[model samples]
Target: MATPEKTGDVAVHDEIQPAPLTTTNTIPDEYRELDNGEITAEALGGMVDDLPKGYYRSMSFIGTMLALCLGQSSCYFGFVMPANVLTIINEDIGPNPNYVWIALIWNLTQAVAFVLVGRLSDLLGRRWFFVGGQSIGLLGSIIACTAHNVPVLIVGSAFIGIGAGVQLSFGMVVGELIPNKHRGFGISCIFVSALPLTVFGPVVIRSMILHMGAGWRWSYYFNVMLLTVVVALFYFCYHPPTYAMLHARRANHVSPWKMVDFVGVLLFTAGLLVLLLGISWGGSMYPWKSGMVIGFIVGGAAILILLVLWEIYGAGDYPLIPIHLFKNRQYMGTILTAAVGSMVYYSLLVLWPVQITMLYDTDSMAIGWKSCIVAGASLLGQGACGVLVRVLGKHKLQLMVSVSLLTAFTGAMAATTPETPGMAVAFIFLASTFLGYVENVALTIGPFCLDASDLGLALGLLGATRSTLATTAQAIFTTILSNKLVTNIPKYVVPAVLDAGLPQSSVTDLLTALAAGNMTGVPGITPGITAAATEGNKQAYSHSFQIVYLAAVAFGVCGVLAATNAPNSESKFTNVVQRKLHHTGFDNKTTKEAEA
Candidate 1:
């Protein structure tokens, strides 16, 4: 037996070690009742009812929840809200060809920063990163609200994206502080707490755009106020066992900063940005065979290959991603599921509003209400999945079922027509519902399979990988929509207008006017011809959108297969809390605290 060295109030091993095993024995003692040999496993099966003192029912826990909810709201406002109102923003700022950059930049920056934020927070601490993220988010809101150009909005989005990475990485915080059996429910509660924003955010933004003089800029202003309060709340209320972990690392003579995989981080960030840039350009900014497009895509793929080699051989003990993570079947399956799920979820988030405006309704308020269907359905699905996971204890089964349902509904969306707005909305609602459930199962599957020390990094990898894949998928879908519209609009609209007795010379004028949403300037345009042109435009958009949904269906099928491979998590769920919340008065004073 060896003596553990003392550092401040914590204990440490003399040498750096691999991640700890995720077993009941590894959970902090205060979270587990004394082994009196009389407590039944049935007693341990309850969710929140079994949560230890410092977690669910305490005031400190309430504070923690409030902080998490506010931060979650900021992430939603910074990315999701802006994404919905991008068209409005473009109208106000005057459209830029690079307006797509506003959304792409956010996803790119978040994916790039996700790796470092997770690793550093694990080594240094979680509190300041959380607070700093909100502060950055506030700055981004300020930048966006004042911006008069697309470039400035893109800049603001980049800053906000980094802040979003912090929130995504730290999502594991809730799982760690609660009973293992309740991880799904616990995480769901945080999301459900932000239900107001998820459901009504789009509608509110749309109303502002239509009714207020400031238009879309008001969304950013609201975020400024929200994030300002969140920054202060997190700074004061969100304290974990970070100081103890830092002290122990210091005692072991391990430099947290030195241990960082800077080279690995840079390689990953650059590789993803280059890859995404290449994807964004193909069929839009540049031709597929053009030197800029091919060069970026191939060069980025090569950099990623180099990164894999560096992680395996070049980085001694401090690889950015633990090599073992790649070997863990459960971990690999979890992240894979996460990536595919995000692809489906964000596809709807980004494209559904466009679909509404193009095919169903052009009014701002109508578009806003239509968009709310997805969010409302998704929240219900999240709550259901969380409750079911707690009761059934079959994570793999839940994942398989959810992903399959999502696939079926998404594939159904490909059948949409200009005349079937009702059916299209139904398909979106069902797809979004299952998409939410799939996300919960994927996130819950992680903690049960990995070590506490690895959890933060693992979560980071999940967020980064999912963000990257989803962003790539989005770029592909956008390209498909753009290319299809180029062909389909003229294919459908030109014929109908010509057949309706419009002169040959007026054909071009009609198209340009229709594209600009104003038929006032077109020659030879009449009420009957205007109606014909409108129908043709809707048909073209419907067909183009159908292609996007089919692509989403392909991704969804892959997710279903991945879900089938997820590890059984029944045994992993228990009364044991992996990490206990400290600095909270509800913790048992008599028990010695556990060190990370």
Candidate 2:
């Protein structure tokens, strides 16, 4: 009556016969009729020798580490390194309003790329996308390095985001290579691989920007070097089975174009873009109630609703995003976790650095060191999570523990007023450590919850969620911070400025400068007024960050709720491919121990 539990990851190496999709009645026919023969070991195209079922256990570690290191390094290169010198870029561009487009364009495009690339890779293969993303990223860095104007830099940022988006899907590729048991450790290693960059990227970039004649341009040049390294590693070290090798035997003669739900793609991408475009504009370029903002926001939401309808009914056989995926409770729950973690992660990525700069007497190097604490703690947390999952075999517990810490620490951050350097360092490290655990657990558990066929799409969906939510979070906090400053600066500094002997003629200009947060830098303010204005600005930032931290706390609480909704999972990894092989009688000798 008692069934044995699965003790270890499924080690199935031989490719299983394609199973019918569980939920859908129709399968897209594009690759279905293409290659009808089974993929023999010789189909490797001279890439490598035949790897056995569960072969990833032996050769998988080193191969996975290399791929992860290269891929994630390229991806985060867009996210992290930019924050190190955003202010410098803003200054160099003469504080142009359009400068925000650098990050805005990058995140928007990256969000689109994440979903589209993931969907395509599922149909085609991941190799060319991997190679292409890095190549394009490298090209972007080159352009950015030489950029003389803000528009040129914005173009370069677009390339960086687009490439990084595709590179991000490599997580699923890594997921495919490793079995479940050691997969968390392998994922941890990928996050850890960025330690060197996180530790040194800012310091080096800041020094280059501040002292080297190359200025902020050197930041992109360094990105180029990192991208070049990833591309090189990819060629020699990467070799995974293509979708064609695995499923082309089942291909129908349907045109690939017919299989592509272009309408869905358009609706999905346009809806998000318009929504984010509206969000980005609100409280920054335009008022929230402005016609342009309201129209785009309403229109984007309506279009997205249309997308849902089409995918569910109208798309017939070819929905852009497979509709059944949304029905998978595990996939849906964990993907929301990814989105919330991203929202928290990205908002802090910008806000924390600003908080540290304004609250403490620190230079960019000091801020860089502070950032290293986060990176180091994340690596530590991720590595430790792998161990905990191995010993305890409960990833949901890890998720719970992570969100608990995140919620508490974020609450603490919200409470601590006038944050000192010591407080900033300690809080950042602790919060980041917990945040890292949450992310690693979500990402690692994602593939395990779905059938192998859905890995790319699921991960793509997660990638899209992460980017979109992050952008949304950024908009939310940027509005909160800017709105607060606009409200509070007058209350705190105006009386002080008017109280000073400055002329009444200067009042309008003074309010304008204060609103711009140029309290000290505004040209005509005397030393006394400048210092008072500085204090007022600092108070405004401090209060604004407290609100953001509180929001982060709310985000963490939502992560816990989301994790609670996860479909019950067995503690360790299940090799779906191997399990399917066993079920189909292809591997009848499956040891009882394999099922534990």
Candidate 3:
């Protein structure tokens, strides 16, 4: 149900046709029967109650969902393209230290925006927010495309991040639109559609960088055009149900500025961003004991503590996150499971591709294919997860088993020797597949347990956890690996270079390059020296990955233990049994009693 995006959440509802669907605007007489149970109280309750005219059921629904899917994919695609060409971008923009902020700004801004907008979106409908965000994102693309300096590009990325924050809202929209029976399938489609771009984004970017004859700026330009059409299509294709339109007009006397948990948003976002910055800068750009890093860590901790206290004690009539959501055993359990899964998988994402390039010496395309296998398999795993949950009748155990196996499997990969063939890559694929399952377990079970009113908060929290936790995990492990590489490379490298008859002066230069992670550069060295340098660098990096994978195994085991806390309140994992009603009689005693 979750896909990565930089935007806010989608609105409450969506539309769809029934089984044995038809494409024609005119429904056949037989096809009309398919509509019998198409609309349900659970599906339509928090969304629109009255259908709009010309809101034809079948293909129209698909078009709306498709547009959403494409919009999200573009954000991801745009994000990935820059990452692939960071080196070129760095070269083009000069060696300004601030250029790093191009990506960092997007990440922090998006994280902050998601937390703020999601809660406000519950009070305010998403139509205008959605359009405004797209407009802002387009502006970001235009800025980046036209940028002549690093600072300008950083500003552009920040705007893109704000716009992308709403991407998680698609889950809320999807859950409201599709029936419980079809929710999983619909959710899978949205996530799966991103795979094509995830798999091919590197290749496309590489082509644009290497052979397309266009500058790196064209990548942003291309995304801008693509998103433009998608925004237009979404504007035309999506028609909020009458209830959603009505909901927009009703004041409910709730001014967003008054109702929003601004203090909580400020504290939580500031705390998390500062903490991540401390983690990222600690051991690389600055020493852990540096005053700046220490200040960030200490201040972030204090702010986070205050955030929790405020959420519990001071939030009256408008909690940032409903207290009951945290108290709910299932919801908390899913959060734990997802956070651990994200940490492990993102760690793998950071370490494995490096492992491939060092251990196998593969090119960017080979890495792309291998990366695709991992991501493509993950997409397949997510789609099949809905079916697996359907058959298993309970997702907790299935997730536990998956995480347990992943623990053993991750450790198994750690045991690999440098000479191991595709064995490491194969295990990476398997590990990624299970990681997808762990995420889908939360996705599948979440909508089942929470009421429609809570869907946006639940989904926003889940998406935020996956992203921020993974980022934190990456910073931690990358620090570990980098520190280890700095210490270990001298031991394994200097002696090898001296043995290969390279002069000490030459060896000194070589070590400096390797220490900076530039194994491909020679700086006017002999072929034999180059070969020795490459082999020595590979040996050093391989050892670092061993530590990373072993740590991942430990997290994987913790994931298993966390899954045990999840509720088995229902035997069935599919949507069939959990029919949450958010209808008009919500306060009625009879309705409450029957639900209980």
Best by lDDT: 1
Stretches of candidate 2 off by over 4 Å are 1-67, 76-79, 93-95, 235-237, 252-258, 494-530, 571-596
Quote model 2's TM-score.
0.82
Give all candidate RMSDs, comma-separated. 5.6, 8.4, 9.6
Show model 3 residue runs off by greater than 4 Å: 1-43, 46-60, 239-257, 504-506, 516-529, 569-596
**Candidate 1 stretches greater than 4 Å from native:** 1-59, 243-252, 586-588, 591-596
Q: Scored by CA lDDT, what does every candidate get? A: 0.76, 0.68, 0.65
Clashing residue pairs, backbone N/CA/C < 3 A, model 3? 6-164, 6-165, 7-164, 7-165, 7-166, 7-167, 8-165, 8-166, 9-169, 10-169
TM-score of each: 0.88, 0.82, 0.82
Q: What is the TM-score (0 to 1) of candidate 1?
A: 0.88
lDDT by residue (tens digit), candidate 3, 528-596: 766777777777877877887787777777778888877553432222221122222331223224345
Comparing 2 with 3 on lDDT, the higher-scoring candidate is 2
What CA RMSD would candidate 3 show?
9.6
Scored by TM-score, the top model is: 1
Pull out the clashing pairs in model 1. none
